[model samples]
Target: MNLTLKIWRQKGPQDKGKMVEYKVTDISEHMSFLEMMDVLNEQLTNKGGEPVAFDHDCREGICGMCSMYINGEAHGPDRGVTTCQLHMRMFKDGDTITIEPFRAKAFPVIKDLVVDRSSFDRIQQAGGFISVNTSGNTQDANAIPIDKHAADEAMDAATCIGCGACVASCKNSSAMLFVGAKVSQYALLPQGQIEATDRVKNMVAQMDLEGFGNCTNTGACEVECPKGISLENIARMNREFFSASIKG
Candidate 1:
């Protein structure tokens, strides 16, 4: 297939960026989106032109680093997959693909398709973990009985990869879904009960501090999320936050 790619190019955070067009010919449907990009970069490099800069690692879709806004959709037209897992088959021959970086005030563009997502790391650090006593007196995690339904829900929430699709897809660039998932992953588990109050409060505080917008219940985040994280997590987080507020 022959394809025209209109990709965003920016030298730095302060650089004025625009969509630059490039053409790739003879692309196979079997090639992953990033692989097709590799072909485009190879063409550019051979012609002594600068290659397009996009973030990608572990192209199998686990790393959550392959961030792209394709034709106004997070992770392209496909559902429940990251940019790296997208394939050429999703587009027809001679298609014009518009590729851009995931836009959010919290995620400042670095260069080309790369954006600074360290804000997510900071949010996680705010209180996404539990303090476990590893001493001899500590109870065995396996011995603790957890309700199957709660365990399943917790596992579902744990699937969030922090890819920012939730933020990019939201009209307000809300990180609530992501934060909710992170919070729910703990809130539903017995091990997380100890820090539940501080966990929700601190994570929400950090999310707000990072300039991410508030959620208006649009449900765009769950629709675009690769892991299919549920809106129920957001509700759970809200309940946790409200309870924490009352306790304080």
Candidate 2:
């Protein structure tokens, strides 16, 4: 198949960027989106031109590194899948694809199709872990029994891979879905209860400090999230935040 790709090109974070067009031919429908990109990069290199720069690792879609805004949709036209999992068959010959990095004030572009997502790391660092003393006499987590329903929900929330699609899809650029998932993963379980109050407050504070916008309940983030993280998690987080505030 032949296709035209208009990809965002920026030499660096401070460099002026624009959409640059290129054409690729004979792309197989079975090729994953990143494979098609590899083909394009090869063509560009053969012509002594700089290739497009995009992020990808563990192309099986586990890493969430293959984040892309394709034709105005996060992770392209697919549902419940990352860009690396997107296949060529989703489009046809003569298709014009517009590819860009996830856009948000918190997710500043570093180069073509790549953004500095260390902001996510910083947010996670704020308070995304359980402080368990696993030293000498520490009890194993299995010793505690948990309700099956709560465990299931917590597992669902933990599926979040920290991909910024939630932020990219939000008109307000909110990180609530991502933050909600992180908070809920622990809020549902007993192990996470010890620091529950502090965890919610600190994570929310860091989220606001990172320039992410407030959630307007538009629910675009859930629609675009590759992991199917539910909006219910946001509601749970709001409750958690309120309860934590009340206690203090």
Candidates in order, TM-scores: namely 0.98, 0.98
Extract clashing residue pairs from model 1: none
- Per-residue lDDT of 106-220 in model 2, one digit per residue for the tens? 9999999999888888888999999867788899778999999999999999999988999999999999999999999999999999999999999999999999999999999
The per-prediction CA RMSD against the true structure, in angstroms, equals 1.1, 0.8
**What would the TM-score be for candidate 1 when compared with the true structure?**
0.98
Top-lDDT candidate index: 1
lDDT accuracy of residue 138 in candidate 2 = 90
Clashing pairs in 2: none
lDDT of 2: 0.94
Q: Which stretches of candidate 1 lie over 4 Å from their true place?
A: 135-138
